[model samples]
Target: MVEQVSVFLENTSGRLAELTRVLGNAGINMHALMVADTSEFGVVRIICDSPSKAKAVLDEAGFGASIANVLAVEVPDRPGGLADLLETLGDEGMNVEYAYCFVRPQGSSAVDVFRVDDERASSVLQAAGFRVLGASELYSS
Candidate 1:
């Protein structure tokens, strides 16, 4: 399990830079991130070493930041791997809300970070033979 920081920012110039600057100044290191934008606003989801500190700085900086639990699963870095995982989840009656992928140079496989409707996603994925990573595992280089 990993704690993701969801930062809600306006869809304006330099907003992403500002957010990064805040985190940088606070000594927070980002492990992975994704940003989605709408006409008026954007949501930046981030995996960081210290989510609590990140959220605190963002909140003091007047950004709407919150924490969410997401499962980081080690998956094969090949086609059909994601499909197999998704099919398994679907068969288990698990609903994946959203997901993203990243690869570490030292790792042999890619990791898929999934936000699911089930709070027991970590256990579910583990029981299904998935390599569910802890926050430390995800952050360690």
Candidate 2:
């Protein structure tokens, strides 16, 4: 299982920089990040090589953080790939709370990481022809 660290941050100056600085100071590497903001706050979802360390750093810095189990699904870097995966998840009765994608390596394609509301992830992967990658597989160097 991949554990994603979701941090609630204020949409103010230096908020994001502070968060990243804390993580960097703690020697935690953020592999990928996605930020969704409203008028007052932002939800920063990050995939780090060391999620526990990242969480500890955020806590020490007085930031509220949460960890969620997500599925790292490798998909082709073409159109309809995401739609197909979402449709499959819908058919399987799995609701996606949020999702983000990162480019795979220089030679590889892309990988979509999804945080599902339900734990029916394995079934979805098997049925959708997607490979479920573990946290180490996705984040570890």
Best by TM-score: 1
Q: Give the 10-residue window scoring lowest on summed lDDT in candidate 2.
A: 104-113
Residue 34, candidate 2: C-alpha displacement in angstroms: 0.6
Q: Across residues 1-141, which tens digit of lDDT does each residue of candidate 2 receive?
A: 688999998899999999998898888877789998999999999998878778887988899998878888888788898888888888887788888899866646688888787777767676667878887677763
Whole-model lDDT for model 2 versus the true structure? 0.84
| lDDT values for all models | 0.87, 0.84
In model 2, which residue pairs have backbone atoms overlapping below 3 Å? none
Candidate 1, pairs of clashing residues: none
In candidate 1, where is summed lDDT lowest over 10 consecutive residues?
A: 132-141
Q: Candidate 1 local accuracy as lDDT?
A: 0.87
In model 2, which runs have C-alpha deviations exceeding 4 angstroms?
none
